[model samples]
Target: MNTQSLTKKWSKTICLAFLYSLSIFSNCYSKGNRIQSSDLKDSLISLLKKSGNDTLMIDSVYAHIRINRRRLGEEYKNTLLEYIDYTTKIQYSRGAMRMYDRLGLNERYDERYDSAVYYHLKSLELALELKDSFQMAYNYNNIGQAYRLQDINNLAIKNFHKALELQEANGNDKGASFTQNTLGAVYVVQKEYDQAMHYFRESQKIAVRRKDQRTQSYNLGAIGEVFLLRDQPDSAIVYFNTAKDIKQQMGDKKGLAVSKHLVGQAYFKKGNYVEAQKFLNEALVIHQKYNNERYIALCFDYLGKVKLKQNQFSEAGAYLLKAKEIASNIHSYENLISINNSLKEYYQEMDKWPMAMLAIQQNQQINDSLFSLKKTREMQALEIEYETEKQEQQIKLLSAENEIKEQRLKIGIAIITLLVLTIAFGIFIQKEKQKRFVLERDKVKQQLLRSQMNPHFLFNALGSIQSYMYQNDVKTAARYMGNFASLTRSILNNSAVEQVSLEEEISTLTNYLELEKMRLQSNFQYSIKVPEEMDIEFITVPPMLIQPFVENAIKHGIKNYTSGGKVELTFEETSDLIHVIIEDNGEGIDTTRGKMVSSHKSMATSIFKQRMKIIRDKFPNVPEPVIADLSDVNRKGTRIDLYLPILELTSTSNA
Candidate 1:
C-alpha cells in the first residue's frame, strides 16, 4: 500500500466521505414474506460501540446481517450492498462515514491500504445513499488518499476535488483546508514546489485560525518539504522547526519525530557536512525508536549522500545499499527512485562503473513498471464502469432466468465431476492400501530370515574358534571367538526389534570388523572412530546398519589394492545432525567387468534401500539417508558419506 493510499483512507472520514457512526441497523430476513429470526443479533449489536470492535467485528457483523436477513436475491442483497456502494459516491450516512474515515485513517497509518480502501469505499457508499454531506466528504478524502498512495495522482486529484466540494457543501472549511494540504503533498511528489506551497499555505492559514494544533503541525511540515525540494535549506529548516514545536505542544510524538527528521534532512540538503551528520544521526535514532522503516530509509539515504561527499566510499555504499533494499521491500517508489539515482551518481564518482550502470538501469525499470501499472489500472477502471452500466440494464431483462440457468448448470456439473473424482480417488487409495499390505507381509517374513541368519553366522564363527582351541592354538583364535560371541548376543538382542541404539549398532560393527581383521591378516587396515560428543546411545538407528557398507569396502575396494590399503570409519555430529563417513585408501572402484560386482553395488545399496523403506513406513516425515562417494579426488581411495538427522528417539519410543 502507498502512503497516498493511507492518507486517502484516513482522510475519507475526516473529509466526511464517512461519518462518525452510532447506529446498528437491525437485520430483517424473510422468504415469501415469512421472516427468519436470529438469536445472535441483539448480543452482537450491543457490541457495536465497544472500544475494540474494529475490522474483525465489522466483517462479522456484515456476515451476520447477510445471513440472518436471508438477503440472497439481487434486490435484497442490492439493498444491503447499496449501502456499501454509497461510500464511493457523493452521499454518506453521517455517523457511518466517520467510522469508515477513522478506519481508513488507521489503516493508512498502519500501511494497510487494501483494508483502508475497503472501509473508505464502504463509507462512501453509505454517504451517497444517505446524502450526508459530512460523510460524503470524508469518503472522498479517504479514497483520494488511497489513490495518492497508488501513485495515481490524477485520480487522487480528482477525488480530492470531490472531497473539497462536499466539505464546502457541509460548511467544513477547516476540513476543506486539510484536504488542500494533502493536495499540496501530491504536487510535491509531482515536483511542483510552487503549487505545493500555495495549497500548503492555504491549509496552514485554516489550521492557525481554528487553533487546530495537529493540522497546523502537518501544514508546517508539508511546507518545509516543499522548501527542501526547492533546495532552500534555510527556509526548510525554519518551517520544520516550527512544525516540531507545534507537534510537541500537541503531544503528538509521531508528528514531532517526523518534523525533527525533516529538519535533519534540510541540514543535509544545505551541504553543511558537520551540521548534516549531527541532525541525520539524531533523526535515525528517532525513526528507529518509532520503528518507521520508510523515514529511516530516508535518513540513511541522506546519510549516504553525506558519506559520498566525504569520499567515505565504503560507508557510503553500505548506507546506500541498506536504503535501496528497504525502499524496494516497502515498495516506496518515490524514495527508491531518488536513492537509486543518487547512488548511480555516487558509484560513478568512485569509478564503480558496473554498479553505477546497474543502478541506472534498475531505476528506469522501476519507474517504467510503476507507469505501466498505472495505465493498466486506468484501463480496467474504465472497463468496470462500462460493465457496471451493462449490468444495470441486464438486471431488468432476463436477470432471474440468466442467474438460475448459470447456477443450475454450474451446480450440476460440479456435483457430477466431484462424484466421479471421488470414486477414482477412492479406487486409487484402495489399490495403494492393498499393495502396502502385501509389502508389509513380505517385509515381516524377511525380517525373520535376516534375524535367523545372523545367529547361524555367529555359530559358524564360534565353531571355528572351538576347532582352533581343540588344536591347542587358543591364542591364535581367542579374539575372533570372543568377538563372535559379542556379535551374536547383540544381533539376537536387537534383531527381534526394528531399531537399536547407535552404541549397540557400532559395537556390533566393531565385533564384526574384529572377526574380519583376524581372517584378513591386515592386508587392508580398518579403524572405527566416533566423536565422544555425538550422542551414540540416544540415536536409535536401524540394527545392523553399518554391516553392509563394511562388507562392500573390504570385499570390493581392499581386495584390489596391492599396498597402503586402509578403511576409516568416522561418526560425528554437526548442525544438529549425525554425519558418518566411511572411506578407504584402496583400488577405489573397478569397471573392467561387463557389470558391477555384487560387492560394490548389490548388498549395501539394495538392502539399505529396503531398510530405509521400512523406516519411512514408520517415520514418514524424516528425509532419506544421503549416500555419496568422496573417492575421485584421491583416486587411490573411496569415501562414502551418510547423513542422518539427529532423531533421538528413546529406546522405548523406537518401538
Candidate 2:
C-alpha cells in the first residue's frame, strides 16, 4: 500500500482500538473508590504490561494524562516524560511520537519556544519514519506555533500551510480548523486584519460544525480583536461577549480573562470608563490568580487610563507606576512604550513639564530600540533566505554534475581521455572552491567576534561623556571621548587582522581599560605588565583574544565589588608559548551570581575556546588555554591563563 493509504489504515485501526481501550480504562477507574496517584500509576503500568505492551493501550494512558493535565499540576510534565521513556524502552515509535508532541505542548505553554521547537521536530522526524500523516500534521502545526511565538512569521506560515495541506488531504477537519486559526493569528500579527478575519471565519465555521467549542471561542475572540483594531468598538464587544459566554460555559478561566480584558478595552475606547473599569478589574483578579504577568501589566495599564480619565491623578500615577515596573522587569519593549506614553500623558495633565519631557525622551529611546530590533529581525530573515537559496543552488549543481556523469558513461571509451581530463579539472576546481569557502568562513567568524564586542559598552561610554558635558566639564568629556575614539579605532583595525604585535595589543588594552575606568567612575583599577625580556614588537598574538577576559573580569567581578576593586594582567613568554595571565581582586564567582554572568561571559568564553581549538588543531604543538578560579585554593578571585603560540614574521608567512 502507498504511504497515505497505509497511514489511513493504521489511523482508523488505532482510533477504534484506542476508543475501546479508553472505555475499558474509564470504566475501571469509575468503578473504584478514590485512589492515590501511586496506586493509579501502578495500575496503569500493570495494565500496560498486561496488554502485551500494545501501542493502543499506551495511547489510552496518554489520553487520560492529557485530559487531566491541568489538574495534575507541576507533575504533568514529569508524567509525560516518564511515558516517553517507557514508550522508547518498548520501541514504540507511535507512542513515543505522541509523548514527544505532548512534551512540546508543555514547553510551549511555558513560553520556552526553543525547547518546544526541538521536541516538535523530534516528533516530526519520528512521524516521517512511520509515514504517519496524522502525527506529521500535528507536529507541523505545533512547530509552527513555536515559531510564531518567536515572531518568525515566514517559517511559521510555511509550516502552518504544510499542516493545513496535510490535514485537508487527509480529511481531518479538526486539524484543518486548528491550522486555520493559527494562520489567522499570524496574519493578525502582521496587521492584515481582513485576511485574518477571513481565516478566522473559516475556522469558526468548521469548529462550529464539528462542535469544537474551545476553538470556536478562540475564533470569536480573534475576530473581535480584528473589529477592535478597526475601531468598531460595538462590533468588537458583541463578539467579545460571545467568546466570554463560551469560555464561561467551558470553565476556561484563562480564556475568560482574555475576553474580559478585550471587552474592557472596547468599552474604554468607547469612553465608557465605568464599564471598562468593571471588566478590567474582573480580568485583573483572574490574571493575578493565574500569575500571568503580561496580562497583569495590561490590566494595570488599562486601569491607569481609566483612572486618568476619571481625574483621579494619584490613583492613575500608582497604577501606571506598577504597570511600568512590571513591563520594564519583563523587558517587554512594546509594553514599556505604552507605559511611557501613558506617563507622558499623566505628567502633561498634571502640568509637570520636566517629568513629561523625561517621559517623552524615554519613549523616544524605546522607539529607537524597537526599530533596531525590527531591523535585526529583518536582517536575520534575509540571512535565512540566503542560506536557503545557497542550498538550492548546491542541489542544482549536484544534479547537473550527475547528468554530466551519465552522459560521460554513455560515450564510453570514445571520451575516456576527455573524461579523465574533466575529472582532474573538477578535482582542482573543488580544491580551490574549498579554500575560498574556508577563507570566507574565517572572515565571517572574525566579523562575528568584532560584532560581539558589547554594544552596551559604547552606549555607556557615550552616556558618561554626555554626563560630563552636562556638568560643564568639557575637558573631562573631551578626554573621555578621545579615549573612546582611540579604543574603537584600535578594535576596528585589529578585527581585520589575524594577529597583532604584542605592543599594539597592550596599547589597545590600555586604551580600553582607561575608558572603562572613566565610565565606571574609577570603581576599579587595572594594571598591565609585560616582562622586560619579551620582545613586544616581534612577538604576535591573536587579535582581541585576551580583551574579552579582561572585560568579563571588570564587568562581572570587579564591578560587583563595593570598593577597592582591582584587575591585573601580566604577560610571560615561555620557550614555546606566551602566557597572558588575567587576575581580578574581587568577590569570587558566587553560585548566586553565576546566572547573571552566564549569558555574556559564556558566549565570549565559548567563542574564545572554539578559536583556541581551531588554532590547536591547525598547529598541534600549541597547548590548550587554561582558566582557574583561585577561590578553589582558598583565594578570592578568578585567574585565566591564555596560552598563545608566538608568531614571528617568517612563521606567519609559513602559516
Maximum-lDDT candidate: 2
Spell out the clash pairs found in candidate 2.
Answer: none
Model 1 regions lying over 4 Å from their true place: 1-42, 45-130, 378-655
Question: Which ten residues in a row are the worst by lDDT in model 1?
Answer: 439-448
lDDT of 1 at 575: 38
What lDDT does model 2 reach?
A: 0.72
Window of ten residues with lowest summed lDDT in model 2: 439-448
Cα lDDT tens digits, model 1, 465-484, are 65665565545554454344
Q: Rate the local accuracy (lDDT) of all candidates.
A: 0.61, 0.72
TM-score of each: 0.44, 0.47
